[model samples]
Target: MKLNKTLSLAVVAGAMMVYSCGGSGSKTETTTSTPAPAPAKEMTPEEKHKDNPDFVNGLALVKQSDCPSCHMVDRKIVGPSYGDVSEKYEITDENVERLASHVINGNVGVWGEIPMPAHPALSKEDAELMVKYVLLLKK
Candidate 1:
């Protein structure tokens, strides 16, 4: 009887240890964490105008023309920057065409006492392309 009681007490103690301390038969807990979101992408001139052939043509045209001699993309040089022109006007089809006309016809007193010379040689289509490119140069 004494031996059976001792064995029963030992079994109870072992079962208690297993229950309290989480033995091999017990299930292990798991956790999952969410990751941070990716940052937003900034658009470049190339990216913004990638779908338009005119934008590509205008980029090439500006390089060939004396447009760079007077104007710059970001800041003022001789004439206003492309960015400044973009800021002054809303970029509609009408504004683009009008600005293109101005590019070909040239103007004075609008920007300053300094005059913008006419590009009589450039085609209307090409001028419009150039204007489109310029308008996209906004900050």
Candidate 2:
């Protein structure tokens, strides 16, 4: 009777271990077989900007830089919102030129006394994209 009880306990313990290990191993296999879904795609540059080369270009330029750390499309932050600037200078070539220059050089007094830091390394073409995008917002 004593030997039979001991054998029964060992069998139960071995079965528990096998079950636990099997459960965990199957979970790992399921995870390996199933990949997470991909993220949603952003709107195309041309569709979003709609033939406004400057805005499209500007978006690319801004993304390349650290500007979004402080600026947003519709709301205030450390700087004027992109929408406000767009509205302020819509339909004006001069505004495009001026704003583009400001991006490369940075601006003070326009948003406030808190001056934007200059990025002189940013090219004229890249700056123009920002200006164009802002202008589109005006519409």
Candidate 3:
């Protein structure tokens, strides 16, 4: 009787240990990919447009121009976020021109090791519009 009681207690303790350690018979070491950094602020639909008429129009142009295929409004995709780009430049005529030029001719080294493809089809006016739209995301 004593030996049987000791064996039973050992079995119960062993089972408790196993249960405490997570009783999933097989260990699954799952590693999830770390997502890119999120934007610092919450965005309302109104925040996207603000008071800029050009940016409002250019927001539509951004979709038509296939910008979202690489860039998102907030987070990183293949390219940096529009918010990230907005953070890169200050509001000024010269900065706008530079951004427009980059959109038309394509720029390398600004983003990362990968180069941005040249948007030859994008007109100068449209490029300016897109730049303005991107810059509007700052606030």
Candidate 4:
């Protein structure tokens, strides 16, 4: 009787240990819940204009070139910011042509003592596109 009781208790304890440790041969699935992410912020005017054909093409041109090395959208780097340029110059045929020429032939003493390097490799059309994109960054 004593031996039987001891064996029963050991069996129960062993079963409990296995059950508590999840060591049973059967597999169990567990799911965890997480909170949903917040909604995306609204895009600014310039950001919204990104989908425009001219903006897209011009942005691509700027990215392909070394424009970022000296200029940025909102803040000045080696040169004035694109936003500043946009604010300084209005969108007009004359302004676009003049700026495109400046981009291709380079300009000095316009922004400051620092000179804008010429991108002679860029065609007039491509340069105008880039200028238009820069101008579109106006706040």
| TM-score of every candidate | 0.69, 0.60, 0.64, 0.67
RMSD of 4: 9.2
User: Is candidate 1 or 2 superior in lDDT?
Assistant: 1
What's the true lDDT of residue 91 in model 1?
A: 78
- The clash count of every prediction, one per candidate, is 0, 4, 0, 0
Q: Which ranges in model 2 have alpha carbons more than 4 Å from their true place?
A: 1-48
Candidate 1 matches the true fold with a TM-score of 0.69
Q: Give the TM-score of candidate 2.
A: 0.60
Q: What is the lDDT of residue 38 in candidate 1?
A: 75
In terms of lDDT, the best-performing candidate is: 4
| Predicted candidate 4 versus true structure: per-residue lDDT over 42-110, tens digit per residue | 777557896788788999999999999999888999999999999999989899999999999999999
Each model's RMSD to truth, in Å?
5.3, 11.6, 12.5, 9.2
Best-first order by TM-score: 1, 4, 3, 2
Q: Arrange candidates by lDDT, descending.
A: 4, 1, 3, 2
The candidate with the higher TM-score, 3 or 4, is 4
Error of 4 at 9 (Å): 86
Residue range with the least summed lDDT across 10 consecutive positions in model 2 = 23-32
Which is better, 2 or 4, measured by TM-score? Answer: 4
Clashing pairs in 2: 55-132, 55-133, 58-129, 58-130
List clashing residue pairs in candidate 4: none
Residue 85 displacement (Å), model 1? 1.0
Residue 93 C-alpha lDDT in model 3: 85
How accurate locally is residue 22 in candidate 4, as Cα lDDT from 0 to 100? 84
